[model samples]
Every structure is written in structure tokens, then in C-alpha cells.
Target: MENQEQKKRDTNKIYFLIAVIVALLGTNMYLYFQKNKSDQRIVTVSDEKTALQTELEKLETELDQANNSTTELSTELKTKDDELKAKIAQLKTALNKGTLTAGELAKAKEDVKQLRYFVGKYTADIDDLMKKNAALTGERDSLKTTVSNVKQLADNLSKVNDSLYTKVKAGAALKTSQIQIGAFKIRNSGKETDVTRASTAQKIKVMFTVANNPIAEKGSHDIYMRVLDPAGNLIIGEGGSFTANDQDLQYTYKTAIEFNGDAKTFTLDWTNRNNFEIGTYSVILYADGYTMGRGSFSLR
Candidate 1:
């Protein structure tokens, strides 16, 4: 009986120890499963965060490009505004000068419309300014032409008046006389004599008579005579004044006569200072500052 009791106690102790070991193994398996689940969740979250950051960076780069395009467009618009203002100023000046025409204004307005169409969204004031400039140019050209014609007409009238004044200053009516001369002769105390025996240094007497006519004015008039030598050369010395027919006159080897109101006979003598040559000699006569006649003679 004692041996059997001891064997039963040993079997009970072995069963207790096996139950303890099974409990410890179940705890360890639970811990390992929980740790593996936590690690998998962490890896998934990290991948999602990386993808989101990359997407955000791409969006920011696109936004920056859009901003740059907006800035460039704004600058271009401001430059166009300045150019439009300058053109408007020029148009205003042309209008004030009265050089703008209606047709040109219409054409310029059409051009402005085309420009605005290209710009997509422009103002109306620039078109109006272009029309005004065109009108001004046309008016200025017309006025210049009118002024030029007026000046030309005035100049022509002035020239015509000067010509008329010149014609009036010249006198209208006049009278003239005819004169004649003949060969030299000698006179012996109022008796006519031939001059064939005269020496080279002897004085030659010339006689002439005037006949009154309607063309000649009846008044005391000064006469001038020019005597030429046989070689058709004038024979007067320098600084000599001779008296003929009661007229004080300067002679280039010639005679002068003072005529009364009636036809009269005149006589004068010239003292020859040189020898005669065998050629024809001539005399020209002037009366009342006009040439009257000419005559010729032969000398041996």
C-alpha cells in the first residue's frame, strides 16, 4: 500500500508541469503576431506620405509658371497704353491746325479698329484721335495751295503796273529836221569864189541853208557837226571849243549852228592844221540832240 501511493503522486506532478509549459508558449505567439502587424502599417504610411510630397511639389512648379506668364502679359499691356497716348497727342495737334479731312478721318478710324481687333480688348478714344490727325493734314495742304496762288497773282499785278508806269514816263510827240553839207568854197568880202588854189593850211569855208517844214519845230535849237578826214577819221584836237553861226560849241573838227524860228542861211570856216589827203571826207550833223543828216566830199 505504501508503494502504490507514492507512484500516484509522481503522476500528478508531471501533468501540472505540462499545463504550465503550454500556457507560456501561447503568450509568446500572441506577442510576435502583434509586432509584425505594427511594422506593416508603418511601411504603408511612409509610402503614402512620399507620394503626397511629390504631387505637392509638381503643383507649386505649375503655379510659378502661370504667375510668370501673367507678369509678361501685364508688361506688354502697359507699353501698348503708352504708345496709344502718344498717338493721341499727335492727333490733337493736327486737329487744332485745321489739317484734318473727313475721308482721312474715316480711314484712320478703320485702321484703329483693326488695331484694336488685333489687341483683343482696346479702347475707343485712340480711333477718334487717328481720324482727327488725317483731317488736319488735308486742310493744311489746301490752305497752302490757296496762299501760293494769291502770292503769284499779286506779283503779276505789280509787274503790270510797273510796265504801265514806265510807258507813261516816256514822252509821246516829237519833231525832227534834215540837214545837208557840200564841198568847201572861198569868199572874198561876201563874193563867192572857187577853192581850187587853196593851200593845205588855208581855211575852208562851208555854207548851208535850212528849209522850214512841218516836222521841224520853230524854235532856237543847237546844232552839232562832226567832220571826218579823208581816211574817215575825226580831225578834232583835244580841249578845243569853236564858235559857229553864233553858237558856242565844242568841236571834234566840226561846226555848230544856232537856228532862229525861221529858215536861215549859215556860214562857217575851219582852219586846216594838216595837209589834205586824196580821199573822200564826210560830215555828220545833229540838231535838237538828234542826228539830222550826213554829207560827203572828195579832196585831191
Candidate 2:
């Protein structure tokens, strides 16, 4: 009985030792698994941080490429670019840490996702702006070309008008022909008779015919006659200075006649206050700022 009791006590002691050993082994396994789980969590957080940082770097590179692609940016676009860069910088600052909790890593992932959306939107906006600017530039260039063409056409038309005006002005000048002069003697009855003797001549009769022109001005025309004596001096009466052939010329007599672009004959009688000289006298007709015709007569 005593041996049996001692053996039972030894068996109980062995069972207690076995139970303690099993508990210790289970505790060690729990600690090792906990440590491994902690290491895996740290590695996951670090990998997430590296991924977030890489995404941010890519975003930054994309932004730089966008900025370099265009010639100029609008004020609004520049402001947006600055805001995106600042946001990326802030996110990078947060991600640059050596470690991150699960919550922090999740927040970082969400932030990067939102940043990607914003980057896409920004790039699309830039493309749209570039397209709009290209369209505007094309329109401006086309407008300039149209204006230039219109100006060139106007200049050509002006030149043509000037040439036509010059031609018309030249075509509207008057001319005279068939100019003749005769010395006449008038009695108290005022009936003139032809005479060659200087003493017998009381007046000189001048006749001329104006040529017809289709383009001449149809109005009352003032005819100017200049009588030059044998001494090459103008026989001035109640005449004034008139411009003819770009010259300030003194005329002897002036008369008015209605002209309708038809050949017309005119006669003028001039009576000198003094006796006629026995020499040749010249007569010139001027009208419309030009010399028309000339004639000469001699008295014995």
C-alpha cells in the first residue's frame, strides 16, 4: 500500500511537470508568432510608404512635364499648378517618415488616390487650354490675313481711281481752232468793213471756233483774249490776271459763252483808243487754264 501511494505521488508529480512544460512551450509559440506578426506589419507599412512616395514622385514628374510642354499658362492654371505642387510637397513630408501606423498608411493611400485624380484633371485641363489657345491663334492669324488682303485690295482700287481721275481731268480740257483776225473800219452806222490801211481801220475783228469734246465741262465758259502789239506788249484794257498753263497771265478782254460740248464759233471786236500802228498784231485765246489758239493780222 505504501509503495502504491509513493508511485501515485510520483506520477502526479510527472503530470504536473508535463503540464508546466506544455504551458511553457505554448507561451513561447505565442510570443514567436506575435513577434513575426509585428515584423510583417512593419514591413507592410514601410512598403506602403515607399509606394506612396513613388507615386508622389511620379506625380511631380508629370507636373513638371506639363509645365514644360506649353509656351504660356493662364493665371488660373499657374495657381492650380502651384497648389498641386504644394499638396504634393506636404504629402511627401508626411510620407518621408521611416515608419507609419496602419491608420496613417491608409490615410496616405487615400491621399495619393485623390492626388492621382487631381493630376489627371489637371493634365486634361492643360490639354484643353492648349487646344483652345491653338484655335484662337489660328483665328487671329486668319483675321490678320483677311485684313491684309482687304487693305491690299483697297490700295489697288485707290490707285485705279487716281489713274481714272487723272485721265478724266486731262480729257476735260478745251481746245480752239480756226482762229482769224481782220482789220475793219466802222462808220457812224456801226457797220464794219474790212480794211488794210492802218489809218482807216477803226477796230479789229477776231473770230475763232472752239472744238467739240465729249468729256468737256458743260457750263458757261469764260474766254480770255490777249492782244499783243507790234512791240510785244500786251494791249491791256479792263482785263485782270488769270492763271493759264500754270502761268499768271494778263489778258486783254474776257467774254462768257454757254458751251454744251459742241463746236461753236465766236467773234470779238476790239476798238483801240489810239490810232492803229502800221505793224503786225498778235492775238491769243486762253480758256480753262490753257492756251486755246492764236492769230495775227497786219496793217499797212
Candidate 3:
């Protein structure tokens, strides 16, 4: 009986040893599996964080590029840009943490997705603004060109009118022709006789016919006469001054004639206070700021 009891006790010890070994193996296996799952979670979180960080940086770069465009942003657009930048900054701060819980990571993912949508909308808004600006610029340029063309056309018309006025003014002047000069002597009885001798001459007579010009000014027209001696010196008679060919000139005689737009002949007489010279004399007539006609007579 002692030998049998001892064998049974040895068998119970082996079975307990086997159960303990099996329990230890099961506990170790469970610990190993749990550790492996934790490592994978950590790696996944790290990779996700890195990807989010990369995306945030890319969004920031795009924002900066949009700001660098040539078009100036409106006040509202600038505010939106600032808000987006702040959002990026906030996201970056969140992603910079060393560790993230699953809930936090999932929240970050949602935020990033929303950020992408907002960024796409922002870019679309910028494109629309740029297109509008381009169209406005084109319209402004076209308006300027139209204004310039109109101004040029007005200037051209003004020049043409001025030219026509100048021509019309020039065409309205009166013309004189058939000028004749005669010398005469007045006897003591007050009778006149034609004479050629300078010493015997006491009066000078001038005759001319005016052309019919309907455009010329009607009414009484003042006529001025200038007499030049053989030496080319002007003979001062009345010492009256008149303007002719843009020059102030002294006249020897002046008279008035009535003009009614009909061809007419007129005569004038002048008695010199000084003695006449024995040479050729030149007589020029002026009317309305123009030289009318010239004539010559000899005196002896």
C-alpha cells in the first residue's frame, strides 16, 4: 500500500507541472499579441500624422502662391485668406503633438477633409475674381481708345472749319482795276486844264473802276491813296495813318465811295501843298486792308 500511494503522488506532481507550464505559455502568448497590436497602432498614427502634416504644408504653399498673384485682393478676400491661414496653423499645431488617440486622429482626418474643401472653394473664388478683373481691364482700355478717337475726330473737324473760314475771309476782299492818273492845272479863273509839266500842275486826278463782288462788304468804303516820288519816298499830304497788309502806313489822300455790289467807276482829286518834281510818280490805292491797284504818271 505505501508503494502504490507514492506512485500516485508522483503522477499528481507531473500533472500540476504540466498545467503550470501551459498556463505560463498562454499568458506569454496573450502579452505578445497585445504588444504587437499597440506597435501597429503607433506606426499607423505616426504615418497618418506625417501625411496630415504634409497636406497642411501643401495647403499653406498654395495659399501663399495665391497671395503672390498680381491681382490685388479685395478686403473680403484678404479676410478669407487670413482665416484659411489661421486654420492651417491650427491644424499644424494639432498634428504636431507627439501622440494622438484614435478619436483625435479621426477628428483630425475630418478637419483635413473640410480644409481641402474650403481650399478648393477659395481657389475657385480667386479664379472668378481674376477673370472679372481681366474683363474690366479690357473694357477700360476700349473706352479710352474710343475717347481718344473721338477727340482726334473733333480736332480734325475744327481744323477743317478753320481752313474754310480762312478761305472765305480771303475771298471777300474787293478788287480795283482800270486805274488812271492825270495831272491838271487850275487857271486863275478856277478852270482846270490837262497839263504834264510839273511846275504848271496844280492838281492831281485819280480814276479807277471797282469790280462787282457780292461777297464784299457793302456800304461806304474808305479808300486810301499813297503817292511815291521818283526817289521812292512817300509824299506826306494829310499825314493820316491807315493799316494795310498788316502795316501802319501814312496816306496822302483818303476818300469814301458807296458800293452796292455793282461795277462802278470813281474819281478823286488832290492838290499838293508842295511843288511837284520833274520825274515819274507812282500812285497806289488801298481799301479794306488790301492794296487795290497801282498807276504811274510823269511830271515835268
Candidate 4:
């Protein structure tokens, strides 16, 4: 009877130990699974952060390029560029906090996508303007050379003529080699705009370059211009007068330009209070009793 009692106590103790071991195994398994799930979440968040950082690097590179050329940047475009930098900084701050939920992460990615689109469009606009400026530079260079050649030809012709011609040419003649005239309207924003409408025209711009001459007098020469309407009536300027072509002529306007014989470009602005007619108008430039160059333009 004592042996039977001892066997029962030993069996109860063994069953209790086996139950403790089973409980320990089940707890360990559950903890391992939970730890692995948490690690996977960390890895996923880290991957997304890395991707966002890479995108930010690309954006910074583009912005650096724009800032380097900021002098040539338009005011409106420069403002947009500054706004983009602020957005990038904000996004980086959020990502660094390590507290973003899945939904917030997704929202950040969408914002990045929109920013990239904006960058692409801005770059395209800048490229287009660069191309236009390049073309204008090329044309201006060609115009300068052509004007120089015209003056050279006139000097050569004078040398081959009679003594009277040579004597007349000895007097320094301020010669214009190129003439460009355009009718423009000033916008409310204070920008000059070329317009086809005659009534809307507020200003006429004249551009020319004086020719280089070793013998030409290097002094202040009064350059005069005559703007004749399509009907052949002279559109007088605000002030000044000069004689040309064996007649006492009252010039429309005149400016005293100091000539040192090196060819240089000049700009003349005319604000015509009188209305413009819808027809071709002629512009004649004169200096020192000599016709410098001629240009013409039409308005609709």
C-alpha cells in the first residue's frame, strides 16, 4: 500500500513537470513569431525612407543648377524654385521623425511625385528661353559686322572720287552702318511689347551702330532722326533742329553722342503723342550733314 501511494505522488509530479515544459515551448514560439513580425515592419519602413532620400538627392541636384543660374532667372520662376526647397525640407523632417504611418508615407510619396512634375515643367520653360536668347545674340553680332562694312565701302568710294569729294570726306562724318526700327507698346507691367496695332503703339525704338573711322572726328556729334509718315509728312520730335541737304531743317529730335571712332550700338526712344497711321513709315538717320542709314517699318 505504501508503494502504491509513492507511485501516485511521483506520477503527479512528472505530469506537472511535463505540463510546465509544454507551456514554456508554446510561449517561446509565440514570442519568436511576434519578434520576427516587428523586425519585418522596421525593414519596410527603412526601405521607404531610403527611397525617399534618394529622390530628395535628385531634387537637390536640379535645384542647385537653377540657383547657379539665378541671375538669368525670371522673378516668377525663381519664386517657384524657392517654394520647392521649402517643401523638400518639410518632407525630410517628417521622414526623419520615424513616426510616419503607412497612410502618411503614401501621402508623402504622392507629394514627391507632384514636385517632380513641377520641376520637369520649369526646366522645359528655362530651356526654351535659353534658345531664344541665343538666337538674338547671333543676329545682333551679324548686324554689327554688316554696319561696319557699309561705312568702309563709303570711305573707299570717297577716296576714289574727285578732289571735292575727298575734301568733303576729310570732314569727320558720323556714319551709321546699321539701322533697326520697331514700333512697340508698353504694357502695364512696364515691359516693351511689339504690337501690330497702330493705335495701341506708344513708342518707337531705333537702334543703330556708329562705324569706326580713323579719320572721323572723335567729338560729340548731334545725331538726328526724321520719321516720315506713310503720307510723307514728317512726324516731328519733342525738340532740337539741324540743317541737312542744303536746307534749314528742324529735326524731329537730336541727341549728342560722343564718338571715339570705335563702332558701338546706340538706342533712341521716341514717344509719339500723335497717333500712328496704318501704313509703312520711313526712318532716316543723319549726323554732320550726312545721311547715316535708313530703316522702315509698317503698322496695321
Candidate 4 lDDT, tens digit per residue, 65-90? 75675348789878988888888888
For candidate 4, report its TM-score.
Answer: 0.48
**Candidate 1: tens digits of C-alpha lDDT, residues 48-104:** 444433433443343334334322234654576556545444443433343335554
Candidate 3 at residue 247, lDDT? 96
Error of 4 at 59 (Å): 0.8
Q: Can you write out model 3's per-residue Cα lDDT over 90-154, one digit (the tens) per residue?
A: 98998988778889999999999999898888888888999999999999999999999999999
TM-scores of all candidate predictions against the true structure? 0.35, 0.63, 0.79, 0.48
Q: Model 2: clashing residue pairs?
A: none
Minimal lDDT window, size 10, model 2: 166-175
lDDT of 4: 0.84
Top TM-score: which candidate number? 3
Clashes of each: 6, 0, 1, 0
Candidate 1 TM-score versus the reference: 0.35
lDDT of 2 at 266: 84
For 162-275, candidate 2 gives per-residue lDDT tens digits of 999866875676777698899999888978889999999888888888899878899988888898888898999776999887799988888877789999998887888778
**After superposing candidate 2, which stretches have Cα over 4 Å from the reference?**
1-47, 68-79, 177-207, 224-255, 267-286, 289-300
